[model samples]
Target: MPLYWHLLKAVPSLQIIAHRIVWSALLVAGWLLWKYGRGWLRQTLAIPRAGWMLALSGTLIAFNWGLYIWAVNAGHVVETSLGYFINPLLNVVLGVAVLHERLNRVQWTAVAIASGGVLWLTANYGSFPWIALALAASFGSYGLIRKLVAVPPVRGLGVESLYLVLPALALLLWGESHGDGGFVAHGAVPAWGWGAAALLVFGGVLTALPLIGFADAVRRIPFSLVGLLQYIAPTLQLLCGVLVLGEAFDRDRAIGFAFIWVALAIYAVDGLLRNRAAPALPG
Candidate 1:
């Protein structure tokens, strides 16, 4: 995302998203065709149960991607960080509400502490963190839908890519016909530099790779752990904003982060205890 911010200096955010959809769909399509030959599309449609689920997931992830890309490029790097920071707690909340999953006292308390951290950040920022909230909500919903989806990771992603890119292709075509597009520019709107163009095409791979991992993880692991691990990406983003991008991180913000850390620690410890207590069965 930090890299995307640099790239966005030259490439438009919507264009980046368009290329992401187009290239990702092409790449995943090639892979599926190579391995499964002509049967891949049929396989995607074979599971009627997962079809609607995957479609919904595709829409959700697209929204999440578009928003994140815009947020990163718009100099809200730290705000994006807050969005991801809140994502896990939001996931916990969703698990309780959507999946009817119960949390232990410790885990529940962890969520409460995390909520406090969010509230503290909101107070310090002097307003409700709408961007953060939207990111968390959209992504958390994506995660929830994906859990119910039973498609294989690569194939599922391929299917989702197709859904996003078809519309993207239409948008690109519309822009090109008017002669003001990036990838297929004619006149009036000059094409991006070769370096930027190359990165734009490669955006597809960049976008799909993490999703492959996430699809696998959400299908296999407990969802809350998936949320917990999300801390890594946001933490890196926070560092990039403060250290690399040079965004201000005041003392009040530090206190807010401290609260989040405390919550994550409690959740981590609870997970450890539960794993240790569970009896191992024959594999």
Candidate 2:
């Protein structure tokens, strides 16, 4: 985590995102090749009418990555963390509004509690938690888009990166011409190589891990429980920001977090009740 903080410090947001996407595309592509072969790549590339639909998702994902990287780089890691905590609720709202999925009473209550927390945060801060809001909104929208799309996750990511790769490469070339490249120009050899390799692996590993976990949790647990755990990353980021970086944690923000905690508690209890009432799965 400290490593990640330092890593964020070392590179610009777009550069970090580009590296992450490139490595993620490579790693996921390799996995697909091993599992399904080049035919999978061809199929992914040949999505006829779906191309534009995917381009939209790709754009949202790019913004999400950019915002997250900016938060990390700009010393707003805690606020960024808060944003992720809000994302599940955003996803639920999207489901209700766009997919026409109906929320249970308990789910509604949970959303209300979460909304109160957000309201409290906004009111106390005298402005919306823009960092958090941007992160949550962009990511929630990205998730919604991904859900609507028919392509497999790995293939979708690969295609998205492929679409963006030319622009990314152009940026790299453009940066080099301006003598502002993060790769060789930023630091010393050992620092650059090891750091670069770590970043590449970090990009690929993070892409795969939470997604795999979410897939498993979705099958084993209720959506609400999965939603609750979505707080973990943000919580960790908040802690790291405060303890590690010593960022400001003011009274209103503290109160705001308190509200969010209360809301999460309400959400958790409501989920437990819902789960108790839900029919048991087949043996």
- Quick one: best TM-score, which candidate? 1
Angstrom error at residue 177, model 1: 5.4
lDDT of 1: 0.82
Residue-wise lDDT of candidate 1 within 86-122, one digit each (tens)? 9998888777787777888998898899889989998
Among these predictions, the greatest lDDT belongs to 1
Worst 10 residues of 1 by lDDT: 184-193
TM-score (C-alpha, index-matched) for candidate 1: 0.91
Per-residue lDDT for 103-172 in model 2, tens only?
7776687688777877777777655688788888877776666666667666776677667767767775
TM-score of each: 0.91, 0.85
